[model samples]
Target: MSEVLVAFLTGLTTGGLSCLAVQGGLLASSLAQQIEQDVAMQPRPKGAPKIGLRSGLRPRPQIAGPILLFLGAKLVAYTLLGLLLGLLGSMITLTAPLRAALLILIGIFMVGNALRMFNIHPIFRYFSIAPPTFLRRYIRRTANREATWFSPLFLGALTVLIPCGVTQAMMAVAIGTGDALQGAAILFAFTLGASPVFFLVAYLTTQIGARLEAVFMRLVAAVVLILGLVSVDSGLALVGMPSASGMLRQSGSAGQVVDVPVTPQSGTLILNATNSGYSPTLLHAPAGEQLTLNVVTLDTYSCARAFVIPSLAVEQLLPSTGQVAIIIPAQEPGTVMRFTCSMGMYTGQIVFDL
Candidate 1:
């Protein structure tokens, strides 16, 4: 699947994952309980709610504290999830059925989450419980439910479960990796990339959450929609994209074939890209064996070239940047291998040395 598509899907999963981590179905219930407690503890106001000073500017600021807490907690959850996925991606092998199941679960979550952009959750509506049972039901110690750091942290965690479309796509990608550690790394990076907005929003939930909530929902939807498309790309790939992969493998730049004389063994190849922004990338290695690519880019200003091999029918994306040694399976011999930019523009190949 395309990296862009995968990024979108990963973003969605991160959203839902965040949601689940933070709330776990307790969002609405907890907020309602908090409302009850607040009302119960305070003396009733004598007159109608005055329009001026008490109401203040926008109500988002009031909720900021809770929002941050909610978002932060969720981010923590996803971070942990990422770590777990990375670790797992490195370990166990997955069966086809398991991969497919994970894909479907992820897809449903992403699509559902994207649809939520249009969804009007009762949680967003103003509903409060009576004060009588407040003490027994409230969860947080915040005096008011209007805004708080915890709210965002909770939402951030629970957001991951929202069933966003892109998350589904990402899940498929993670599953395809065949190794638990790699899958986890893919998810971890994806979630990390997508969490900043929620973190910021959590900090500002008080003065802006009401207005921004809708925007956030829309953004989440957009992310999921993109991810859903990527999921379709990958899911379809498992069935067969031999034709497309073939097309990608068909051509390379017209540079003379010198067969660069670095004799790395049949199972391994170390590529030291001589120029800035370019690395000798490969594709198609046997899926089960350990494979290594040693990359070094000359320029510090421009990040070095990263690599990817799309046709293994596996779930992880090969790195396109950063100087690090990651362990991945060698592509199956004869599998179409095509190298591309970190941005997914096809560059060249290693055509598996079967």
Candidate 2:
């Protein structure tokens, strides 16, 4: 539930604006004829000042029908995409290394996308994904044919081919779920959350001018850059590498050692998983002793429930409220094992002491 909510909020904020920047052209083209017709149908009273482009007067089109149809098709398309991604994920076992690699790759793409938005380098423009030339020509031809009910629907579904950076990030998350229903739910929630912003911006850009759109794109670029960095950090953490946050923590706690907790039962350590994060992020235990690590979760619905120990190739989806025991073999002195949520958003470590 918490995971779904987070996805929803992400869509409402970053996803909406980012998607608009990429796909707004399609929407505007789809409604071009309709907007013209609406403007034509408006009555001009005699002796009234002439309304022109410079006059800042235009008809507000009745666009609810077309917009809803477009959004509905888009929602369905992305949900099916999520289902397919989840099925693919379930078919193949994604090990920690593979998942880490995927995360890093997606992160790089997102960062490149932000750079492209900023026009930092001409090479960064390659980060923009587009349909094949033939397909693009065909879609444009079809969109220009007429303002029919099918135009918006077709364009909306086609958006799947040219997803924005944030949408791609969410798609990566859907694939990580490894469950079709859950993946579908996540995408569905996200798309629904994004609809309002998409609609409002589309309406405003058509009715008003491009100035607002420019400002929104700049904001989207910043958000995309931040998300990209976070994704890279998460991927690094997943592989037990030194990440930005981890480095900061290490620097802050330099020369300060965390004492090994005395276990209630010898050779067993207990850790709690909550909605926020893992408790006792640092732990220590005697080396050369076989150990049982018990993970307890009570009403936890966040990503923390998807527990992972990357070095051990261990991945477990914990129940909302339960205890799961993981057996660890005897380790050499000075051995350090790191654990994190599947997305690497939450993390902890256990150090084996002599």
Candidate 3:
């Protein structure tokens, strides 16, 4: 459906870019480890005494297998987590205070993690629930010494524990979906979107010995910090605080209105809905005329599917791909009507001028 497609596309583009800072280093490190292991296991030439340790190292192990397993595991984990979050959301209505507290806590955790990544100080490391020394040793042994087929899969699964502000943000939105399927779909799409970068970076490291670790890590630190601030603001907005994000505002726009040339005979206007957002978000219409708002949606599988017009008490759910017409009563001049998605994340409006 459109929702899943849109989610996938979003993940492919913006989500993938955001993930570079979060998972880029981890993917590179894992791939490098696998390559080193593969090189050490290269066959020794006949009658050739090993000149040195790991002499005549074989080429790095084909990353295709490990990368596939890693991404697949992440996809499954994210989808499952999303389903669980959605179920929990359906069971309890989160009060504003509770939601804000949760968001703020998540934001603080992200900020602290970012600082830790930057090695700002040793103290920030203590803020997280890190495994004990013994547990870390066990993990390292499993990954390095054993070198079982499960190593890449295990590492991918472990990514769920690593702090990622974008993932957390998506998790919050998934909770609003109120259904397991929708939640899973959203996360699956996001993970899929991020997979491309994971594969690309991993390939570069293994294929060409790319040395971007330092640069990418710094970029990740900056992104995590920004995401932390955004998370905190979103939480504040939940508690009746004015939202700093312009996407959620309900107030009328003062900008010049788009003059939509409606059909003179039928007073009809056609609007297209895409993944990025609604085309022509603001429209100007003539007053005192019956109007048909024909919204043409093609594979729209996003929050925008839940259309709303607060002033007219209009709430409509759009199909994944189709045309839906809503009757708009003749309005008095100077009237402005606003419509948004169910979460109020995406907005549009109609202005009637005499």
lDDT of each: 0.43, 0.75, 0.65
Question: Which candidate gets the maximum TM-score versus the true structure?
Answer: 2
Top-down lDDT ranking? 2, 3, 1
Per-residue CA lDDT of candidate 2, range 1-354, in tens? 666787798789867766765665566555655665676788878876655432445566777777777788889999999888777766756566776776677678778877887778899878776556675566566655744566678778888876765576577678778888888888888888889888876665545544555565567678778877877888888898766765555455556654456384677888889987777677888788889999999999877888988888889889889999999888889998888887767777888874
Give lDDT tens digits, candidate 3, residues 1-354: 455675677677546545544554445444555665665677757886543212342264678877878778878888888788777767755443554566677668767767876889999776445445674566567777766445567657767766355566567557767888888887888888878866775554445422454455567677767766666665554443444552443333345344576777889877766655565676778899989998888977766675656666666768769989999999998987666554444566677874
Listed in order, each prediction's TM-score against the native is 0.43, 0.77, 0.57
TM-score of model number 1: 0.43
Each model's total of backbone clashes: 91, 0, 3
Candidate no. 3 TM-score: 0.57
Give candidate 1 regions above 4 Å deviation. Answer: 1-61, 79-90, 95-101, 119-193, 200-220, 241-354
lDDT score at residue 246, model 2, on the 0-100 scale: 57
* lDDT at 172, model 2: 64
Among the numbered candidates, top lDDT falls to 2
Worst lDDT 10-window in candidate 2? 49-58
